[model samples]
Target: MGKIKVTQVRSNIKRPQDQKRTLEALGLNGIGQEVEHEATPSILGMVKKVEHLVSVEEA
Candidate 1:
């Protein structure tokens, strides 16, 4: 399987609570935080939740 890299590119300020939770759940505590996660439906859903606050790339 391929790895997916999730990076927090934008600030979470003023964002929805759920999106903040998604970022935290993904191990993103602050802006510029990046984490590697397996490409799965659940992770994809989390990514979608905070897509505007983050950037994703294949790793």
Candidate 2:
């Protein structure tokens, strides 16, 4: 699978617990933090859940 870069673009404060957990799961601790992961179905699903808080791009 291709690798994708996921960047936390927004704060998780005031967000739902699940969303916060999703960000943590993606290895993001704060805004501007970026993590690279394989573009697998599971990761894509997780990204979709918190799409508003992060930006995804080709790695």
Candidate 3:
């Protein structure tokens, strides 16, 4: 499978609890932090939930 780059582009403050947890689930702890994950359904779903808060790139 291919890998995806997930970067936190925005702050999680004032966001929903679920969105905060979703960001954490993707390994983003702060603005500008990044993590590489598999391009799987589960991860994609998480990314969709917080799409506005993150930037995704194929890696």
Candidate 4:
């Protein structure tokens, strides 16, 4: 599997609870915080949900 970097790019204050939890699951606590994870289907799905709140990069 390949790895990807997920960076929180926006605040979760106005976002849904699921998205906020998704960010936490991705290890993001605030804007600019980043976490590298394997590009598994499940992980990708989570990313997709909060796509607007984050920036993804190849890792």
User: Which lDDT values do the candidates have, in the order given?
Assistant: 0.92, 0.96, 0.96, 0.94
The better candidate by TM-score, 1 or 3, is: 3
Model 1 misplaced regions, further than 4 Å? none
For each of the candidates, give the backbone clash count. 0, 0, 0, 0
How would you encode candidate 3's per-residue C-alpha lDDT over 2-58 as one tens digit per residue?
999999999999999999999988899999999999999999999999999999999
Worst ten-residue run, lDDT, model 4?
14-23
* Tens-digit lDDT track of model 2 for 2-58: 999999998999999999998999999999999999999999999999999999999
**Greater-TM-score candidate between 1 and 2:** 2
TM agreement with the true structure for every prediction = 0.93, 0.97, 0.97, 0.95
| lDDT, candidate 2, at 8 | 95
**Which candidate do you rate higher for lDDT, 1 or 3?**
3
- For residue 54, model 4's alpha carbon misses the true position, in angstroms, by 0.2
- Cα displacement (Å) at residue 50, model 2: 0.3
**Span of 10 residues, lowest total lDDT, candidate 1:** 13-22
TM-score of 3: 0.97
* Regions of candidate 3 where Cα sits further than 4 Å from its true position: none
| Cα lDDT for residue 18, candidate 3 | 97
Candidate 4: deviation at residue 24, Å?
A: 0.7
